[model samples]
Target: MSSPRLWLVGCGNMGGAMLRQWVASGVVAPDRIDIVNRGDRDFPGGVRQARDLPDGDLPDMVMLAMKPQQIDDIAARYGERLAGVPVLISILAGVEEAALAKRFRTGAIVRAMPNLPVGIGKGVVGLYSESADAAARDQVAALMTPLGLVEWIDDDALFNVLTAVAGSGPAFLYRFIDALAAAGATLGLPADQAERLAVATVQGSALLAAAADVSPAILADRVASPGGSTREGLNILDREDALKTLLVETIRASVRRNAEMAAAARQSAVGLGRITLFPFVLSLSHRPSSPRTGTRRTALRQAQGERQGGSSSRNRTKRLSWCRNGANSDCLEGAAMVPLYP
Candidate 1:
């Protein structure tokens, strides 16, 4: 099948990388792609580049590869022109599909998180879309196939987690490699030689793990003899699961930052009237009384009083509580008394 006509809004690092791979892999012809950027830059042969979008029929796909903060400016400028575009793919981090849909009218909007390795077609692309139909999804999957490992996220909430892991994982791995080299250098080895050895060791190990049928944990066991130097090193890393804990904390930090960005994007879309609501349900672990009428009566009275007194205003806080059954010990087990919007 012929490749879709693609208009890339930004030809910076990530976008340019994907563009190069698409052209080199024959997934997209240079003539079929157009790139719009603030200034001229190198691109694959036959590809068109311009400071402004060309005047022609809308392309089959419009990719927003610019920074997330530029979403408003870009949408305001091209929203009308790009209305009803078949597929809108955004590589802007932290920008959710809802935010994009609110700004631009499109048949489908896909949020893609691709790392830097996509330049060499060995990256991980995490994609999430709620508006895409089956065909649109297939087109996106096909486009990313040449880039690297493409994963479709079913839950939008987990997109940030994926961004933390696959999208930002390369840099983390690079840091680990650097640390390994530094440790080796500290042990009296030549710094340059240690760096080279560290890089090669990590590369070979990763390749082996990928080709092995067993999990990485099992492969790690195969590398360490029953009572050898490797075992000593492994003990240090595995002590109280130190390495695992450190990684978990690191990824969690990334997840939190991604969530902040997403919130900022949503706030930008909604303007100053945005109010974030966090819903939490408080359930009593133990029964208040002997599951008789005493606990049920008191709980119901308090809930009724709160409901009657509460105001349905954004400024006012609301509370609710209730009993599930009057005769059971778990009567007041679950009582959802969450704050409601005005």
Candidate 2:
């Protein structure tokens, strides 16, 4: 298939890696790609690199590879020029499609989470797009196929989990390799030899797991003879599912961090008034017969009295009180008056 006219915004480590892989794999021709960055950097030969967007017609697709925090500024600066681009693929971690939609007017906005390994055509790309039609999605999948495992996420919420797994997973594996090497060195092997052995062992195991029809758990069992040293080591990792538990916590931490980053991006976008909030009901439940109801009732009465007295400070305090009294009529009244921020 012929290459799409692609423009990469902010070609950094991850972006540059993908660009190189695409050109080398023939998924994209270097001559058909353009990269925009503030400063010059090494890029694949025949690809255009510029300090700003190129003149004339927009490309078939524009990929946002800049820092997540730069979303607002980039939108403010280039939104007009980028309006109606066929596709806007973002590699910015934690920045969602909703956030991008608020900024750029495009046919499709795809949130792609590609790990560091993608540079070598061995990475995993997790994609989530709500606006992209079937053809646009297929185009994205085709563009990512040369890079590595490409999985389309059905739910936007799961994107962070995917980021935690594949995006931050490589670093976790590297650390595990380092720990293995350190353990080997402590057991009397030369440090360099131990490091080499650890790396090779991990690489071979991963390749085998990838090729194996059975699960990695089955493969692990295959390697552990009933009375073998491998079984002894396996026992330690299997006890209380220690390795599994540790990895769960590790991935959870990463997922949390991704969520935090997403929240920050959304907050920033809202703070800048670049995004609009749709009116939605926030259901809050409370038992009417609860002992606290009387206290809440008294609080509501006080707030109403204060508002009637025309005290601005007291009015604000009343609104806050009503918000805290979930399910109470006062809360409903407060909900009517309170403006929800996006």
Best by lDDT: 2
In model 1, which regions exceed 4 Å deviation? 269-342
Residue 103, candidate 2: Cα error in Å is: 0.9
lDDT of 1 at 289: 38
Model 1 steric clash pairs: none
Candidate 2: Cα lDDT at 242:
86
Colliding residue pairs in candidate 2: none
lDDT against true structure, model 1: 0.74
User: How badly does each model clash, as a count of residue pairs?
Assistant: 0, 0
State the displacement of the C-alpha of residue 178, model 2, in Å, after optimal TM-score superposition. Answer: 0.4
lDDT of each: 0.74, 0.76
Q: Provide the TM-score for each candidate, comma-separated.
A: 0.79, 0.79
